[model samples]
Target: MADPKGFMTTPRQEWPRRPVEERVRDWHEVYVPGALLPIVSKQADRCMDCGIPFCHHACPLGNLIPEWNDLVSREDWRAASDRLHATNNFPEFTGRLCPAPCEAGCVLAINQPAVTIKNVECAIADRAWEEGFTSPRPPERLSGRTVAVIGSGPTGLAAAQQLTRAGHTVAVYERDDRLGGLMRYGIPAFKMEKHHLERRLEQMRAEGTKFRPSTAVGQDIGAAELRSRYDAVVVATGATAWRELPVPGRELAGVHQAMEYLPQANRVCEGDLEVSPLSAAGKHVVIVGGGDTGADCLGTAVREGAASVTQLDIYAQPGTERDEDAEPWPTYPKLYRLSAAHEEARDLGTAPAADADARLFAASTLRFGGDAEGRVRRLHLVEVDAGRRPVPGSERTLPADLVLLALGFSGPDRSDGLVDQLGLELEPRGTLARDAGFATNVPGVFAAGDAARGQSLIVWAIAEGRAVAAAVDRYLTGRSRLPAPISPYDRPMTV
Candidate 1:
């Protein structure tokens, strides 16, 4: 403990975000520069250093939360970074993207607001990068084993990094033109700039992880051929099949899946694309989904100068406070969240200015009404009950020139021929099926991340990747020393 009475003396101070009006005009991150470092030490000192440290159990990556909190509080950023990287291969990514279930599960959160675990984490990572504490750790000796990892998402990258560090020659294959998978194109710059992803890729490359981008495994290299070439094959291809809206006017122009819209905006931000084909400029955008993806679209549209933006959710609005019965202490609560995009929308007065952005809950999109040219012009909607059945006489029409379906993903896209060509079996839920060790029915082929577990947090993907790497190591060498963060049956304490 940095100061015995620190928790009692220092009140929690959250990171300050950039002013909503100013941030909405550009694609920069939401938080103000150097805004977190000053308060982070005191906030980190608030950690109780609990007897059991429930935050570790809460985080899928099992980050050493209290230890790092102690380190940060003591201003030992290098030590904090080391502790953080012990379990999580990409702290910067998780620090930015994770919802911080670890903070929710903090023993302090049983009463007062939790210690700023996530903020401390981000600060440590940022400091490490600035101070040159982060470097590649190439193994001293070769294990004379080779592994093929499909997909370059968080899981695949983490697995490849871990395996390479364990002295296995690893090749990471991505269908995208660049590595980092969704981190490269799916996530918008406002959430986390792409440089973070790029830097990590550079480190992995220096550590002897070979990257093969723009190579679709099932199409370019047959799955059988890939298996034959490597001692073990790990499938970390994330779930890519978007959950689509099957409503009447889905075929109308301007209607597109969230994945379809988000990538174009991200590519444009990268300066690789001169213009996005589905630019939201001067259009009335209606996003059908009130999740993170929808929030992402909202921010993108606002940056693109959309005339108006509205996000709709079929479910009723979550309570402002925790739902105690449904979500007990130490479990992640279903509470209203104000994302950065929501803040920007609120400032713009695009929808209900008073109510924090243009979000409509308990709403259902009935159909799309289009112009004579078959372009989406309006959206038909109705208020619905908990059962999602239409409420009596609540029909309405909302103008929309662009419709983004942010309904979330279902499973991996099998169309690329990866699963079919590999003859891999999928679970009933459409995710790739795996045994106790993350191994598919086919010998030497293992699956992890969203490809096997469905869409989830980045932390979970990295954890699964590490665990699957250990499994693949065992399969290749008959025994292994790699750490398996969580067993398939392990239930993460989600707070």
Candidate 2:
């Protein structure tokens, strides 16, 4: 152990974020650059090195949390980076995007604050890149097998990287003009800058993993033709068919889905556009959801200089503390947590109609009202009960110039014709049907990530990617050394 009494002696501290006033003016990440490296060692020392190590169970990738924590606490950066990369292919992405369920399940979190696992992971990853610890690991010999992976999201990228390292010739096909999928366009720069993605892509290219950007599989190359060309095909297209709000006045102008708005702002950052056409500048915006996507919208609108921004959650506000009767410890509980975006909205007083955090709990949308030009002007809603039933005499309206529906996604968008072209079967919930080994009904075609698992955390996507790569590897050769970290039936631990 790095320190026997470190858990008792040290307190938990997180990476400091940039000032709201300073961050809202720029598109860079919200965290202060290089601030995490200083305090992360002390935080990692707080890991207790539990006997059970529930943090491992909490993580879908089975990340070696305690081992890496010990390494970091001892200032063994090289060992820590090796341990961190043993399971997760993209620690930087997970460090920035994951909600850190491992921290929630920390043995220390049964009482005191958990160790800063996410920050430590990020620090290790960043230091690895800076110190030249990360380099191209090309295969020693060719397997004489080829694999084509559809979609260049986290899942597809992870799978392609693993397969290529195992000596299989792998090519990743992305519909977008660039790789990284959502990380390229869906996620805003304020969350994670694009250079991190570019550097990783460079490593993959050097390692012999081919990339085919702007090539839609079902359209540019038919699925059958792709299967015929490659020995195996892996479909990692993410779930992107957004759920819509069917409420009245849905056809009004200036109303769009969260996916529709986020990409435009990202394009502006990518220099593809001078400014977003759906920019929230000088407009009153109302977001209809309380998930991470809604919070992303809240931050984007604030940066865009929206006149006001309010987020609506259909469920009642959760208590600050976990309820033992409802959601016990060791499982991720529903609690009132303040994200950086909500902090910005609260401090700036952007949504005066809602609570201090600019969030309305137990709120249900009824309809939208528009002006003569068919532009959304106001949103009509009512207070709701725990069951989402409208309360009797609590209706209200708020001025809303822009309406963004962050209701989440359903499944892979079939409009590209990938699924139909492959003659693949889908689950009842719209996800691609897969067996225990992540294989679809079609023989050589496999599915993973959101396309097979539905919308899930980024960690889960990478885990599924690695697991599917193992399955595909085993199929090509009778035996394989690839590791599968998770199964198709493994669901997130819940009470």
> Which candidate number would show the highest lDDT if scored against the true structure?
2
In model 2, the runs with Cα more than 4 Å from the true position are none
lDDT of 1 at 433: 91
In candidate 1, position 405 carries an lDDT of 94
User: How many clashes does the backbone of model 1 have?
Assistant: 0
Residues 1-495 of candidate 1: C-alpha lDDT, one tens digit per residue: 887787788888888999988888788899999999888988888988889998988898889898999999899998999999999999999889999989878888887888888888999999999999998899999999999999999999999999999999999999999898888888899999999999999999999999999999999889889999998999999999999788888889989998999999999988989879999999999999988989999999999999999999888888877767778778878788888888788778777512346798889999999989999999999999999999999888899999999988888999889899989999998999999999899988999999889888888999999999889888877888988998765665543
Query: In candidate 2, how many Å is residue 127 off?
Result: 0.5
Total clashing residue pairs per candidate? 0, 0
Candidate 1: segments with Cα more than 4 A from true spot? 353-356
lDDT value for candidate 1?
0.89
Give lDDT per model, in order.
0.89, 0.94
Instruction: Compute each candidate's TM-score over C-alphas.
Output: 0.98, 0.99
Q: Pick the candidate with the highest TM-score.
A: 2
